[model samples]
Target: MSDDDGLMLNFAIPDNGTTTTANTQSKNVKVRGGRWKDRRILKLELEGRPKEKKVKGPNSIPIDASRKRRMEEKPSKPKSSQSNPTSEFKRAKFTETKGEHGGKNDSYVSSLFTNNTASTQEVPEESKEETKTYLPSNAPDKNATSFAGLGINEKLSKHLTDHQRFKYPTKIQKLVIPNLLVTERDLFVKAQTGSGKTMAFILPIFHKLMMEYKHKIGRESGLFAIILTPTRELANQIYSVLENLNRCYPFLVPGIVIGGEKKKSEKARLRKGVNILVATPGRLADHLENTKTLDISQLRYLVLDEGDKLVELGFEETISKITKIIDDNSKIDETKDKWQGLPTRRINILCSATLQNNVKQLGNIILNNPEMISVDREVEGTILFDDDTTGEVQTNNEHESFAPDQLIQSVLIVPPKLRLVTLDASLVNIANKIEQSGESSRSIVFFSCSDSVNYHFDVFTRDGKKFKKVKDEETGETKTILVSPDDSADEDQDDAELTSPIINKNTIIYKLHGSLSQQTRTTILQQFIKDDPKFPHKVLFCTDVASRGLDLPNISNVIEYDAPFTIDDHLHRIGRSARVGAKGNATLFLLPGLEEGYIDAKLKIVHPREENLRVTKYETILSSAFGEKNSTTKNKFDKLGNWDIHATTWHLEVERWLLENSSALAKASHAFTSHIRAYATHLSQERNFFNVKLLHLGHLAKSFGLRETPKNLGKKSSKNNDKFEELENGGKKYKKEDPRKKMLRLAKLAVNSTSEYNY
Candidate 1:
């Protein structure tokens, strides 16, 4: 297959379930990262890793943070004889956190913008309008025959077309796969979430493992490929993908060993000698310590899925221990008494949706002569600052194919006070639609925490005896029930009007959170993924645990019941539905009504969003009935029962807020805060350091939609034609005065020219 760019693909692969042997006799065949560049990979011959005694098992791994040595800041001024003034580049020093860890004080807490009342600022006409999207690349080609065209083995290509049915390769897949086969470089892949990144690394690693195994250079076998991810669910998902592909090459056995699963079972699987192991770091380390059958000394390929998340301090110790154990022992022994040793050489692939600086640092530690490939622009390890003019917003690479083209963004006005009741309404409607269509509906509702998830689950499953609504068998009448979102156990059983809730049919809801046992979560995921027409878990309420790496198929809608805290979270949460070139819908519910605090919350969401995502927009669907200060929502009482005056009022208030503030609310995360966390309050200790704040007046202006106002020239968006819009009388150009000239004219040479402060 060839694209319009004239890029031809090679699909010839093995049809028989047979492994190809590597020709060891071939002389110095070109390898990618194996033939390392001096500058790309730092030589450790004279900088050997600190020597340590051999760790017999995982039990020997230390949990303590590895001590990091800091290079002291140079003295302010070196003596004249020792000073050098000609250095071309300078580096900044790391900040010191030595004394801040123990201090707990209320001095830093401030209600930066806790507005108690409503305030409105008229936005400029130009500012009120949205910007036009810029497409820099030609449209994607969907006419490709199969994955084989992208250089896959023929059998694999046929399976892709006949089984997986992926007719074309994604942008990252096209860029990554070809390079992996042709070049022998360490891989650092940063594709957007849901971009089929798992395959990008898996295929290459599988191919290499097969080739290397055929040549027989490494030891007669243990696991050849080890995929380490952060969470259990993610590990399972990666394992599933690997298992599916392994069917073609029946010789390869893939297994998963994640936390919370039985270690005995894991050992049993390992005892059988699996060809590939997908695991979470903690458990893998544990088995490595206690289990006698586990061995990875001959490991050929090491893949870090969601590499950015796993490279953090929390998992750093475990990862370092694992890598050290797998590192060649002979090379280390050669330099045990000296500071010289050979670098550990192995195939390393690090993958993530967002590659921050810390993740880059991790690549330096493990990868040699790595090729850094991303589907989008750069992301960060640290926060961007208001004064950092060098920083740029996340841009869409016109060529990137990971972003779902048909993803539509929508917002449903909802109040925190009536969140559950409103959720019930949404679910009831969704179920009705699914029944009418005779197809299963797949929707994920994201919450802020596990507590919220549990609370909502109870409400959904609760059979009302007290707070539950009662229905008349003959008249078909029902009663409104009000249950606290936080405490679903509260019910007024004594009320004669309140009756047991009629069973809601076709409402097969599943809950996923960190608190759920690994086995239970796995079961729930299985039921949810069940595509059988008979019964399926349709609705899933979860936290961020399900956001990053889990790929649930046929997810048609992603609903955020609670607003996301961070911009990246928002992107990943919605990414659940619009995956693998499929169109999907996302609806976010905003909780804060029309108030200043609400706008402040909106600012927190928007700033981060503007930094990394630009091509998407949220449709403000708030109707006048859902307005502010009105706590009542229709709450679909007509469907369940007569709505409580208060619940109905609150529900309407949510709509009113959205309707009244549509201009601000439509910006999605950038324009609102719908959910509030307890830790966000000033009374919370941990809230002090991470609370969002406006850095400067210009930042505040930008957040409030005044970024393009005449005076705030510090920031500008291409679509803000402020000057053009402000033109009066035939679009005549106004002679603008330079501030520098104005300052000079107003100052009148303040001091005597000869006696100025400067020499």
Candidate 2:
């Protein structure tokens, strides 16, 4: 037989059996002959089975009559010829059940992904009246006739008008100068920062000393006044003010003895004698104890400038010691005999911007039978010299910390990843304004830590070459020499780095913080104050070090790049500008989400006037940051499209710069870690708004040009584990350090830092 004819076996069906449709179809279907392995079992399995044959007659089972009736009554199921019995019905299209597995997991994974589309919801525009920060009217005050009207000496007032440019006394000066010049009673002076508090107390002392000099009183006579401050900067500033006043009367000498100065020089000057002395608490205490030439037995005035800060710096004990020593040295009999027209006994004047509990406590220690003098809040843009206003004003402490009315304060609700670019944009805007105005302008940027200030200073100055100061042999003129990395040591680099900028090309950049040497800090402050007509814009990146008592003139803007530790800090940071009613702007950069609540919960109290504050959109700032031609793009014709391009390109440039320089990368990492640690140090009351636990660590790292995950970035290798191991028995393993102890150590570092005093 042929291969096709090999399967010849056939089965016959009886005629009586009913032919089902499946069986009939199978009967007609043919199978090809093949080897046993190739035969299809599945195909055979599809065929329907035949019914079994019944046994003959009585031997087989009898059929019941009801069986036919039941079979006839049952409805038959329709069978389709194309249906396969072995195949499963299609599964119901997958439908996700709602709320399964405790709903979707909450995650911060989205923060890790870069949002290429900078699609931000449009922030509502505030009304002109609501957003506007109105400057105090320049309209002539009928009462502000001259400094002489405020009880200033005629010669001193004339000199001030001619040289010092005292057109008119400020509100604080109007209130304080007259009281100090006329009364021998102790005074507690409280007013807004930048409201002429320094001049207030200084002028009265100058007037009294100038009056005494006419009686042939010289520096050799005795020390008539001693001014104590919290920081060396403030003390030096007060001394300078005294010197300026002294230009009229050179016989009345002023001397400063602050930290970071040569004791020998201070001693030598003291031996020559000074009519008025200005010194920091710690240094003054040392001088009183160690320097015998420093005589306070004839001291007539004890003026504590920035008294609140003096107490805040934990100098209360030192100040107490100094005050007690002064009391013991100054005999009532000697003070009465030394000078006429001045107080019979030493008059105590405590000047502070805010009257918090600590300040009150400080006042109790230094001030006796004190008269409380403060600007009345009810009278807008006016100072009340009404003698009836006595005792401490019973008001909210929050209200007491209000910013100056002329300061245009705004808040930017920015994301962590966008902070760097947004800051650059804001600075560019300020620079552009300076360029358009054709006038010299100064600005300050406040950071949370010194490391952050250093990192940002490097980032901004990376594009320019550095130069160092050199003295010319023939002309004897000091000039700068181009300093290259190969020729320069690491320590000398920062001195020349301030002259460069990556974005604000014409703007000079300066970095200041507590970490800088005292001399370096003093030099930078002097340079910032000295206006070089060549550079129109000057920006200083500093910590709270620049926020306090140092009066930097003509500061047009202040940028609080980091949220302050307290509301008082926030007020003080902005107080650097808008001095004595000058128009100025301030911006606070706040991360979005929980931090946004600060605007209403805390900031409103410090800035009650709605017109002085507005919410600035980060998108607007980012878009305006780039010019007509994107600097990153080489092609002039290739224009940038949107905010996303500006942010991404700028951040990428920063990251690239960090990658190329290992030192900068290390600084950035250090700044990132320090920032996180500092963020946790906010006051307990402010924890609701600035909770570190709510922060997105990965996103914040991007601000510092860091790409590593937070876990990896903060994790240190176990390199010291071997050092802790014992030598016996292959070394016993040391237990892990307690996290609570680690946290306490970091807190101690923050508290002990000099950041608060410097600013």
Candidate 3:
């Protein structure tokens, strides 16, 4: 064997010109130079030792030839049914299934869930089918070609098709019109929003009156119908619809009596006589008790439009009183014999989009042997559902409230500091889209209070000015800010190119709220609904005044700048769009952190039939609004820096504008204060998600372009000092009111001052 098979040792020693001899017992050893000539050897003394070898263990043993051959010859077996317990549980907990619409059925637990059972419940097999309840729809009937098919007279049908361009009736109209015309039973109709519920009842009343005109049905034929609405705006809209339908028979006069109108004028009109009257609950109740000329004995139909809204607005007591008074005054039943087609007794119809408990109570108060008509819903007969086991009343939670499927609902979780800048960017993006498509777009941004609306409207329409930067002298950080009209003489200056107003010149902004005069409210609403081709992009900044019953066409987008106080309000805010089968978009702005939890806790299951809610990235919106500026370097941080830079610059300009304009600053401060007060008024159940105490005061102030701290904005108004007279002024001296009592008084005032238009 070669000497390499044996272990060998080597050591080094200092070179001293001495010869060394090698003596070994085995012949396998070899020796070389001993003066450390070979540097690779260790420079230490060592006793020669052999290397130890490791013994083979079980894991290191090679497989037997027979077993290897058998394994290679046979195919591998499938995995067994049993799996690790923890892994099986994980798979069971998070197994996602594809819905019919291609959305994933998220089975993961929500972080907002407080119930332990709900969070840790065992998931059922997705393959097993579960019963699903569908909400109501407003889809038009393809088979019913014309209004005549739904029992409308020939004249009215022709006018509808040729004049109004209403060729086909919706599903609600098809069901409701025939029932009203054929039978005298009262109706409680529940249908989707924007589903022509107005025409559903209007046509039947019109057709009956027109058919009986030869029998002396004229404008002087006594008040035949009384339509009660919750708001003046809706009452006005109903009157307009009635006018459009009256073209077939111009002699059938319809008049409106609502608040914000002169009672003298209404009384004069009532004396002149009107066959049909449309009025709000409060105004109508007043006319019923005060005005004797307003006759209701010959009333054939008492229709309650938006019955749920009326009840929600605390009009139930007024409605009940009106109905009782009318009942006590019904002495002309003999006159109904002459009107052959009309109902022998006054017919009561309650209409609403959803059937809540309050609406059901209102229906019970109005309807007599009513037919509950809910098209496209699975339930039959009546909407008064009862639990089978407990015999307790139950509202259909599945169809409690919902948005149209065509409405694209999305949400953006932006930090409070970025809300104002993001809002500007979003508007710019929408305007750009309208310009690109060459289509007119109407957008509405809803705020919490009128002050907020006022402040924001001023910010946008400040003479169409843009913000610019200048150098600061105190900080010496090269920071300067100024504002001027975009078309100013300084257009050629370098500052002009820095930042322009987010709103376009073609944009028209309108503000409407309860504080405005009635005439102003009517004028603005009329102008808003009227199409203006000159301004393709129209934005209305208002509170909840415009949320219900008013049908403004071509409303392409809705932005909820402030979260609604309740889920019902949220539904109504978004219901402004995607009406009558038209496509639209709704965006909700939510602050980061707890506000984000509102999505899964409340909004996730709002619509039972489909999942349309999506979370949009704020950065993408920012990019679309403010186009990317030219940069030398491109990276993640660089992109973030660009967004931050643009937002800072725009906000700086707004701050500077506020500094110069004292009036605007005052409005901003009031708005900031009112917003906090309103934020506390959210419903108790939803308070956990929108707690006012959790807000970052400084950051929220930034959104309103207010640099002052929250404490300064929240100071009590000094104007109230006039109420407390001094002893020297010859009036009784008064002590300062306790702060707690003052706060309680203000809170009560806030609650009591809430109007239907604002709240």
Candidate 3 collision pairs: 470-480
In terms of TM-score, how similar is model 3 to the real structure?
0.72
lDDT value, residue 21 of candidate 2: 54
Give lDDT tens digits, candidate 3, residues 526-585: 867777676788889888887877788889899999999877777778878877667778
Q: Give each model a TM-score.
A: 0.55, 0.77, 0.72
Model 1 / residue 136 / CA error / Å:
15
Residue 73, candidate 1: Cα error in Å is 66
Deviation from native of the Cα of residue 528 in model 3, angstroms = 1.5
lDDT of each: 0.52, 0.72, 0.70
Q: Model 1, 497-531: lDDT tens per residue?
A: 11113213445567787766676677778867877
Q: Is candidate 1 or candidate 2 better by lDDT?
A: 2
Top lDDT prediction, candidate number: 2
Per-residue alpha-carbon lDDT of candidate 2 for residues 384-487, written as tens digits (9 for 90 to 100): 12122453423222326578777788888887887888898899888877877899999999998887898998888776555577899999999976564355
